[model samples]
Target chain A: MAKRITLPITDEDIKNLKAGDSVLLSGTILTGRDAAHKRLYELIQNGDSLPVDIKGEIIYYVGPAPAKPGYAVGPAGPTSSYRMDKYAPTLLELGLKGMIGKGARNKEVVESIVKNKCVYFAAIGGAAALIAKSIKSEEMLCYEDLGTEAIRRYTVEDFPCIVAIDSDGNNVYETEPIKYRK
Target chain B: MEIRQIKAETVTETVKKLFMDCNYFIGKDIMTALKKSFENETSPVGKSVLSQIIENDKIAANEEIPLCQDTGMAILFVEYGDKVVIEDGSFEDAVNEGVRQAYCDGYLRKSVVSDPVFDRINTKDNTPAIIHTKIVSGNSIKITAGGKGFGSENMSAIKMITPSYGIEGVKQFILDTVRTAGPNPCPPIVVGVGIGGTFERAAQLAKQATFRSIDSSNTDPRYASLERELLEEINKMGFGPAGLGGNTTALGVNIETSPTHIAGMPVAVNICCHAARHASATI
Candidate 1:
């Protein structure tokens, strides 16, 4: 059975998680991608207060499709995490505890994951429809001008993911491929 | 000289329907390949992930929703007959009209930005498609419309190398590109390789290559074998489905080649995700 985790997660919750563990996350998480991350990084550099609180929150790297009538969000899947590598260490320093996205992260981000006692999770890429079903509700948070890239908050139920990089910095992307090679 | 007068409405209507259909429906060839992989994939995680992707496709079709959120920037490859003439609107206008309506009515995401550098504003209707038109010697016009999401598009690369690098160089580059892309392009990708042309032409050929079905092989036997070899090598990399780990990293590697100058050997790798959403219409 997969581990079941609820959001507003703590360093303790994430530190106990290990790479390759299947997880079903339930709780409030924020969504952002390249554009939104850039804006947030700029705000931090300018020493201005962020529009959304970062402490103990998980950020999903996604820009979902527009929802149809009676839907919370449409096809919300994880975008590639490497694009956000530049801003991640800063967010880690600011108390960000978890990240949900697809693909591998850079070396620095993995280091930050270990140092800050956070976790990096991978939701299946291109499995957007399946993932979106877990989002129970969604509300726009900031950067409305960014369209789908806008920051939104989602309350997800049993959102499926794998711990790609755990607090100790074991990375599935790096180690898993080596085991499978002929 | 005979001029084939084609109504602008024909182009607009065909394009609109193609865009919506391609986004919601996974191509039959890709669907079959996914099913085949699901059975063949060895890793338990990889198998389940493949099953989920297939299920997602089914849900998108039954629900009439987009298969993925990135509804993509509209890209059309037009094979226009030299003798054909649009009766009312310009060809470009009709194509854009079709894209505009499909995105708006289909509830697909509007992903195109008006400007790449400054102001980066959303066009709101996925307008101004990236169109590549080739004037041919026939009366009928053929349009291949593809919804290209950027997750995979961002992983594509182009390089200009010396002709002396030859076939071995091309093979090495293709493997290297796929290796670097890893899971970022979404594994089990369709690789479109363009070789032996000018920089722009090679890039165009790579784009055209992605429109080919995953089930089909290159017409030329030499290139066909190369495709098979590359596919085997890529699968061995163990990127698998979703790159968690397995033996099915790439579904197909399609190569399109054109004659080039003596000194130049330009190659482009256009990696497409499993959704490889595209459809065609000829009128």
Candidate 2:
């Protein structure tokens, strides 16, 4: 039987996650990407006020297209997570419960994810339009001038994602490929 | 010279429209290659992956959605026909306007930053597209739109020298790049190789190579053979979709060659994921 989940995820709940676990995420997710992440790290390093409280929230590594009339955003989907690995440990320490992206992460980020009891989730990499459907609404939280890189709060519904790396430091890219590899 | 000026705003909107259209429409060449991927995928897992990709493309096109999440850095190749002139707006500004509208109105991600080393700030509109302009003897402008997924973009590189190395050296370089790329560029990639140009030109040709239809063959028989050989070797590495493992890794290989100085042999490989998004327009 598959595990059913609700929001307000805690570190403890995150620790229970394993690769291939199908998760239904709700609540608030903050959107960021390479540029946004670098700026966020700079703020944290400089002790500046962050746009949102980072504790126990999921952060999506994405930059979406402009929304059509009556739409919140366009073709929103995850980017490569590894590019942001440099700053991930700090976010993990800041109480981030989950990270969203496609593709694999480095060893250090994987270790940090495990240590922080955070889950690295992968939304379908290229299904931007499909993923866009999950975002019920979006509100710019910070860096509004940054446009797509702006830290926006999104309300997503049944956003389908796979657990690529679990809290135990198990990596789907490394281990799973070995089995299916000829 | 016939001179005509286009309103900057209109040019901008056109680029945006192309961005949206490219994601929704998979050209015949690409469609054919993807279908072959479905038929030739030896592993059940790989075949299933290919089918899902096909299904995803259909859903994206039918739903007018993006084929992949990394709605890449918008790259434009502009060919300025000799007799035509764009009025009011500079060529660069016109291109940027198109990028902004595509990213903003069409809801494509704006992936570019103002700077790379410091102050990595998103330009917001995915503007300042990586534009390569050429002057040709015609009275119209043509733009090629390409949205590269990040997984493949990160693996692109340029190398210098090693001519004494010849084809064997080139082959080794390709293998090395793939081995190092691992799961990063997304397996089942279409690799674009550029031979014989200045370093940057080689890079440009490599990227240009990706915009060619997947099923098209290199007119040069030598280049075509190189393409086939490289594709075979890459698959032997056992990197499957998302690097999950399978017998098939790459769907195709493309090489764009240019004449270069005898002293220089610059090579570049620009990688493109299966969700290769590109479209063409004339204005």
Candidate 3:
């Protein structure tokens, strides 16, 4: 059975989750991808004020297609999470509670997830159209020039995901595949 | 030989329709393979993910939207007939214009950047598609088009192996590449291997192999058997659907080959995600 949870996930929420557990997330989350992450990292390095608050926020790594009429977003599946590995640890250190993306994280990011009590969720990659249905509304947050890669705020309802990496550093990407290997 | 005059507008319209249709509709071969994988998948997580993917495809087709957000860089493999003459505009321009129309008017995401390293600005309409054209003997044009999302594209690899490396060398390289790609390329991935060509030709053949239908096999029997064997080995890796874990790591393995120099045997592996959007047209 999938666990239902809301956004602004707390340390207690992270603690209870385990690798490979299915989850359905609701409430609000922020969206960012490769380009957006680069900018955010730069802002952190320079100690500049961020356009959006990171404390207690969950970030979804995605660059959704433009929505057609009567749709909130278009094909909004997660992008490859590893591409943001360089910047993920920094964000996690800043109180970002969770991340929703596909694929594995590097060693540093995994260590940071443990240290910061953060969780990493994997939304089904290439399941964009279905995932988009969970996003009820979207508003551009910043970096509009990046087009689809821009940062945005999304209100989600029952967004499906799996806890790929739990706060204790248990990682599905590392452990689950071993069970099925022939 | 009579020249068949094809209007530029016809080319534009055809390309536009191809891009839009390919994005909206998941290929029948891929759908069938996914269904088979779903039935065969053992892991509960893998089964659920496959089910969601199948559902996503249906919704995209019925609603006329893209199957994935990364609608991909436009790639066209053109079999141009020597006796056919494109009127009013060059074939390249027509194709790009078609891409522009489909991306802008069809509401597809414009993912193309104007440059790679410098001034990485979005071209906005996904114009200037990557086109591979070959002049053939017939009087008609056959086009195989695919929107190649980079998630899997980034996992592709090419290598130069000597003839001494032999068949075993080829198999090892392909498997190694897939292993390295792991969960990143969005399994169950389609593995496209190109053997016995020059470095670049090998890469091109690998990409073309990906555009081939998953249900189809290589014409040569030995290569066909190689495809089957590789598929089995890859499935054993347990990458499964969305790479969480399962028995069906790869939905299909395709091998395309060409005769090469006695001294060199180059191979390339092109990985395509489960969506595997491709379509073909003849004119």
> Best candidate, DockQ-wise?
3
Candidate 1: stretches off by over 4 Å:
none
Local accuracy of candidate 2 as per-residue lDDT tens digits, A1-182: 33545666776667778886667676678899877898889999999977789888899998876665666677776777889999999998988888888778888898888788889887655556667777899888888777767898898877767678898887777776566443
Which candidate achieves the best TM-score against the true structure?
Answer: 3
Q: How many backbone clashes does candidate 2 have?
A: 15
How far does residue B59 in candidate 1 sit from its true spot (Å)? 0.8
- TM-score, cand. 3: 0.99
Higher-TM-score candidate among 2 and 3? 3
Higher DockQ: candidate 1 or 2?
1
Which regions of candidate 3 are displaced past 4 Å?
none
Model 2 chain B lDDT-worst window of ten:
B43-52
Going through the candidates in order, state the TM-score of chain A alone for each one: 0.98, 0.94, 0.98
> In what order do the candidates fall by DockQ, top score first?
3, 1, 2
Between candidates 1 and 3, the DockQ winner: 3
Calculate DockQ per candidate and list them: 0.79, 0.42, 0.86
- The 0-to-1 C-alpha lDDT of every candidate, in the order given, reads 0.92, 0.77, 0.93
Weakest lDDT window of 10 consecutive positions for candidate 3 chain B? B104-113
